[model samples]
Target: MTGARFWDMVCTALYLALYAALYAREIPVPAKRRSVTMSDVAAHAGVSIKTVSNVINNWPYVTEETRQKVVAAIEAVGYRPNHTARSLVTGKTKAVGVLVPDVSNPFFGTAIRACEEALVEDGYSLFLCNTNEDAERERYYLEQLLSRGVDGLILWGARLSCDELEGIVGADTALITVELGEEPRRSNHTCINVDNKGGACMATEHLLREGHRRIGHLAGPLDRITSRQRKQGYEQALVTAGLEPLPEMTVAGHPSVQGGFRAAERLMRTQKPDAIFCYNDLMALGALLAARYLGLRIPHDLALVGFDDIDVSSIVEPPLTTVRIPQAKLGRLTGKVVLERLRGSEGSERVILCPVELRVRGSSGNSFGEEQKKATLDALISSFSDGGERPA
Candidate 1:
């Protein structure tokens, strides 16, 4: 063959080879998978869309066999019911709002977890919002929850009054408030109060029995009804014991560790109470630290007591003596009641006072004036201390 003919054939072969390789490397784009819908499920199950809707909504009229068929078809097609559309048809969101003062606080955290679990068991979603004990923040969350059309609300330590809540919350919405205001009857909501006064009275009486004549209280914010109730109980117990409830012995704090530390130091320095009762476990923990820093031994030089037996209370060097409020039970009960209201089984507006038990631990002494030699408090201090010095 001639040189030109040979060159042209070679180039043609190379061109064909390159074209084949390029075509082999190209990937065919797959078609987008359409989202599986209730319509698809109905079609797959050989049932009407209405049947599928009824089944999804758990309408009791549907036959068990038909429900099974629809459920099987849903599994086969991986069809997810459109929650928005379902909510629109049912006029229910199947969502509950839980507003608390502080989520970071263990007391509220445990309650929230228990409440969420209970709600989830009934196919309801929980929307959590922390108000941080601010009225404006609480109002904002309330408005937001209301706008979202939540079917129910569990307000813990709510700053808003029942009238304010009723103004924002729809009449159809179920409301449950934990540790709220002193209003006897909201007539539209259920209130759950911890026996703050009774618990306080018990703590004071226990200290009195221990022979601690001078007992100081590191109280929570006075504006909060829980705080006031606790203060009242403290005073009642003191009066009952033939002891005067001196104003100087009561110090209002933020109901936090730091607050407790400051309030405790002030109380110890000025009032010099042989025994101290704190509003909650957190404050008591703080008071414990303050006592250690001041070189006073627990149950010896100073007897300590607290409320709300939180988890950390037991794990401390000396387990805290506190009033157990059954926080988890409170949460579960709140969820149960709210669910009942949602199902139209509960309609009466009432107040529930959950019982509190006193858990006596090493913090409080068995008898007064006992000189017990305790350890140097180095372990607990090192665990939580910020390595900061006490104020001069």
Candidate 2:
């Protein structure tokens, strides 16, 4: 053979040898095992497929002996019925859809995790959709879930009207709302709620008992029930304390950091409230930053309290005092309610109201010092009336 041909033959032989060695080292693919079907189990058990189906479906008429035999056969074959086929027969997908406003929000994220865990225990899966708090987007996702045949839905802070919800909650589809209360006398669907009003009242009353009569509120948007309820609580607490809820003391904005900053700025410009209660922790954090930038000492100059005791709330400077809600419990309860409805229970929809509590911390400090309490109150009142130039 020529030299080049000899070299080429040698290289090819080496390559083939390496390929064989690699192939020998690799794990072999096992033969694909066919899944055992109902027919196979029935034949082995000496029973008809219909009898086996009746046993599987838990129909009342199956003889106990026959049911035992069929179950044993199923166990022997390790048979699992095709869920899709079973769903077709029963007209139930055994699935729940969850629509959240913002999955990234810690509260929503925790809730979704809890809901998934709870539903999985009942042999149901979760189909999650993020609506981003957009009414149009929420409606579109709702219709999609319904069209895809989810057995029920859990809507987080839904913006839809009673009429719209009624149209969707027609026969066979169960609906539940989380973190939002039902409108007056509207009783079609179930609702899971945190006590927004009570939480706000506790937060505000905490400030009031601490001698913060000139309190400000960094309120959330007026559209949501949570925002509105918290506002009501704040106003009620002030009235109960015999103090008017001054218009200059409250500013409405989004439930975000920037929103809180803007609202605080407005309050600081008009009248420096002795304390501020934010709608949520995110807003409270923003207010905190604003207070720092304006050279105001927390609690000493302006007490700060927030709702939603998220993890970060404790880690922030001064360790915010806020209201803690059972976010995960709320989600788990909602899942259970939906699962119950899917299992053929029917009645007036349930309303599960979760409780809330205030977590005291440094932000809402001892406003009433032995020597400074009266002086601080006078200073706060003077600050409100002075109309002094606000921080830029």
- Scored by TM-score, the top model is 1
Please, what is the TM-score per model?
Answer: 0.84, 0.74
lDDT value, residue 236 of candidate 1: 98
Q: For residues 360-381, write the lDDT of model 1, one tens digit per residue.
A: 7789974322222122233324
Candidate 2 residues lying further than 4 Å off, grouped into runs, are 1-81, 183-188, 346-349, 366-392
Off by over 4 Å in 1: 1-32, 184-187, 346-349, 366-392
Model 2, span 1-392: residue lDDT tens: 89999999999999999998888677879999987899999999999999999988779999899999999999999999787899888998888899987777777776777788889987789999998878899899988998888888889888876568668667558777876667423443677778999999999999998988889999987888888999999999999999998887889887788878888877877887889999999899889988988999887899999998766676566778889876666677888888877766666456767888887777899633434433433443453453311111
Query: Candidate 1's C-alpha lDDT?
Result: 0.85
Cα lDDT of candidate 2 equals: 0.81
TM-score of 2: 0.74
